[model samples]
Target: MATDKPCKNLHRSPSPAQCMDHYGCIYENNHLITLLVDPENGRIADANRAACEFYGYSLRQFRQLLICDLAADPKSGVQEFVEKALPAGDEQSNRMFIDRHVLASGEPIDVEVHTGMMKMLGKNCVYTVIHDISERVSSEQRLRESEERYRDLVELCPEAILVYSGGIILFVNKQTERMFGNKKQELIGKRIEDFFNEVYFQSAEHNKLKTTGLLKERFRIEQRLIRRHDNRIFDLEISGVPVIYEEDKALQLVIRDITESKRELERAIRLQEHRHAVSFPLDSKAVLEKLYIPARTLSGDFFLFHKINEKQVIGIIGDVTGKGITAALNISALRVMFMDSLLSTQNPVQVLNDLNLKALQYLGEDYIAGCCFLFDFGTGLLKAAGAGINEFLYVPRGRDCERITVKGAPLGMFESSEFEEKSIPFESGDRFCFYSDGMELLFNSDELGRDYGYLIERFAGAALQDDCTWLGLNIQ
Candidate 1:
């Protein structure tokens, strides 16, 4: 039951020191405890029922203790907190402070201490209220650890991470400079839509396209912007999503290099056309297949098959190191050298020496390394020789392979390294093969799924699936 009580100032009896626990006294009793000190000295002050429960100290026990005696911290952490919280000029006021309290049983508890100034019996005094907030400290520590873990995860991603809001960049990872060629400081607060093409920027289509992963289709366009420092345009593709940021929607973008993908697509298109461009004149016995894999857009392998005489057929096979249009150009020059030297019935070695000198005159010292093999099908005799380019050899199983060694220094290596020749007999049904370093490097990846090498082997001994020339030399 609850009752309205007369005010203490209205001639009511002085309040008892013990907690009343009655409804009328509940609010005051919650923060009050009896004073257990002697009258004159004010030796000690009793804690209230709420304070007793808070500090795990009994009212009688608390009344025997002084605040100064209970507050001395044996541990440095507590003392440091008290010093920062309770500076000078803070004694008599209702100062908010944190302190450590050692109870009668010697257990220490952390507290937020609130002090109130008071005057009792014409003596100056202070009433203190202690509240525990240990759970808050622990929760703050856990929140810090969770934030650190999230930071570490963001740092470890291989691609460049960009955090933005409302199309303006807010944060960027270290890889951003490598991918976008811009410093993080220069990028923040910059509109991300500036990087998008005008066609996609008008309707914010680039921003929407990433959600569907379709913006990558315009990776070709990103190649246009050159970096300020090196003038090297990045072959980068970006994917991004919109998220709530600072209570508003922001976008996060991630970028990856797609240069190799662009090159592969170009090569695929060229190879499709090259397949029909080169072939033997008349069909013979063996099914001829050649696999041509250029380390770049073009390759170093070239061949030509034509009638040398009324009854004789001539065939040539060559491998050149270093590629692109340059190596392809050297392959073209080799054909010219073969035509010029072929009329003399000279050895394959002489033809290459002539070609090497021509390549040096045309391409300088960095031109190419190569090997050339020729066969006169009328006599079934095959002659082979080479320059610096090796690891490329022919293996003709069940018959003479006509193995050839890299003889001279790579064609572009020296102005003059002698070309030496070797010969072997070729028979019907013999198969010869050549390969580039990219062919063997195809399988060197952590991801062990289908790869370039796996696809090449599938066409092995059946028919080639690569872009190169296979001169079919057989009897009609």
Candidate 2:
């Protein structure tokens, strides 16, 4: 895209002194830094204003210096440039190379040099154009370092990491070999389907479709796979993110073994079902109406009611910390403690205190939030105490529901925890509702439209979420 021009005409024989003045004007206004150099001795014959500004030298000073003096390694580079530019038959040919040049301030810079032969003052000379490429070189170095860091990070990760392109394995880390029971080389360039059995291939196909549909997005799934070395099937939790590999779309997968967690989940479900099997009497006199629903196979909520004597009945509703098997175990332990405490003492405050003291024996760092109540139909007196049960609804005869707020801490946290017993007068038509905290999840949904009329207005059109348990008793 560039053309060469000689000072005056090539056939003219102007004086060498006038050569600089005439040639200088020709290249002074050129955008590129331009210089005319004697190819035989490497001496600069003339320099344009742009070259003077670029080298931080005046025209008189720059013309005194040799072309080789500008290069970082002057002797070797200048020799090469002179040899390449002075070849006899290549008068119009251009030679290009990259070299380091020293700036006027002694700072070093990278530049691309374009050199071509020219005739000036009836003598052979070379014209050179220099372009600064320091930023470009620096950018390329940074990109190389960034790619190296990425590879190092992926290789050292604890979880199995893999990169796939076009549905084939393109890369795998050291952990992948350990996890899949194969060498890293064995996975490269192989199709992902080659690693799994037919049953697992079906699941992998489905997952592949999901991942492809979510290009440039992130997703996670749990599935079972058979280890190639041992034929052992285990659960794997795979997380994938779309990425660019060599400028093409690819998927990066991180896999973790979750077989133990899956087994624990199954065990928790069975324990939760068995522990919650303690049923309440459905008779009209004891518990009039009841509803219980667990959010998952394992519930962290429970409700229990037992007749203390002919005239009195005791009941408790509790929400335990956490979910799954651990929560179920704690709920079962708390149930036993609650039964023992109430049987020994009818005072609601004393019963709560006893359970709190015994909780440390069976529970770990977990706590129980609950309200306990005892009703005596003979004396028309009802006593209630709570430890961290925030919502308790009391409905008076032919009246709306009201919340009973008991300021107390959760059981099992502190040995010095205390509970205050609240007493209310009970009448024939007065009804009391006892429920676990999770019951609030369904308070606003159509699922509770049958029993809770006041909540129908409060939680209208809301979705059911957490576990729900409710017990209602009407004083006879």
Candidate 3:
């Protein structure tokens, strides 16, 4: 070890030789990879034991090589680093550089080099401390790759995705660009509230709560948005979740277009209303009145009255097993079949049996609770058959009301279902009411009455949980 130069003050009584020996011992035995380089020519003047072992090179071989020989990039050698690291005053300056270095084994490794000015044998030199940062660099590179993959997934997503911070748009996916009719470059850095109507913000307080970190959980809401290109307003269902994006708290919004769905809903409402608005045959002499109330936009309850001639009318009232479009479709199919069955036979028993066969073929597992009745003004007799609806209200002239029940299984349950038929004598000034099961709230067997007006008033005020339909026939 060369120890001619004295070290900085170690103690009061330490001699020059003793200080030099102490400095050499620490420098050579240090655990950190250290090197002494000639600042003028980028030559490696000396290397510590740690440096020799780390680079897989002997001390003599390291001394024979220039500093640029170890550098992965020859342009960023020690001389350039030392010149940039020189201090303005007499004070020693320290600088840090991240670069790649090649080992004696010809393997490239990432390194963080800390350089400072120093003197060795009365010549200016640069003392460098090297730290192997391969692991840290590898971790950062992996993180970048993961972020890139996440961005690709977001871009390829089917729904429109938007990321915003403090109500200012930070990012938007390709679907968002297509939905808003705007380029991503035009949308990014813009305010999110500009495109959406007042429905999105709701109130100033809601907007504040949304932009701030107070709302952290996922939430969904429907709002109207205007396209930037054509200014066309459309409905959108937006679901938002709070996320950490680019080290900042942001809201990631997933949006779905619900414009077509809303339109279909409106069309269904109109069709259901038209179905409820029943038009009785003008040629029929009997006074027929009905009240149909649906709990939802679509009703499963249905009633149809077909006037056979001037004195005879055949009618059916039923409730399908389920709700919504499926039930509505079943009701329509059954109505068409009922009309066709009446053409073949006006008998209540044959009409119901025909309908049961059609229901089994068309309805699959679904069923219908219904009653088919034939009223004959010519014979002054009413014939009724029950499938699932087993009861009817019978009011005789100047006599007490009676609950007439004809019991049988609902349609579509069995291939050979046997329905029971009932015949009752009727006269002038008597009345009858046929209703679906939804009217059970007001009319049980014991509550049979002739006052249809009062029952309708009470039913109008009640909270209906299902579809209700009732048809009244006054014997005129």
Best by lDDT: 3
* Cα lDDT tens digits for candidate 3, 307-380: 88877878888888765666668787888888888879999989989989988998899998899988888898
C-alpha displacement of 205 in model 3, angstroms? Answer: 9.0
Q: How close is candidate 1 to the true structure, as a TM-score?
A: 0.42
Question: What TM-score would every model get versus the actual structure?
Answer: 0.42, 0.71, 0.59
Tens-digit lDDT string for candidate 1 (1-476): 99999877886565544334343365346654333332233345555567666557776776766555666465444234333434553544446776666765677766676655555445555555567666776688798999689667777778887776555677778777556567778788776544434344444444453243332232212333444455554466666665555565555677777667666556644643473366654355334444444432455666565555543445555555545555555666666766876776556677667766777776665554455665566677766666653433344544333334556666656766787666666566554443432333443222112223554575455422333432333333
Regions more than 4 Å wrong, model 1: 1-276, 285-287, 294-299, 310-316, 319-346, 389-406, 434-476
Better of 1 and 2 by TM-score: 2
**Which candidate's TM-score is highest?**
2
- Which stretches of candidate 3 lie above 4 Å from their native place? 1-12, 74-78, 81-91, 120-123, 196-200, 203-210, 226-231, 272-476
Q: What is the lDDT of residue 297 in candidate 1?
A: 41
Q: Considering TM-score, where higher is better, how would the candidates rank from best to worst?
A: 2, 3, 1
Clashes of 3: 0
Report the lDDT tens digits of candidate 2 across residue range 8-68: 7778887778877775666777879888888777888888888888889898988888777
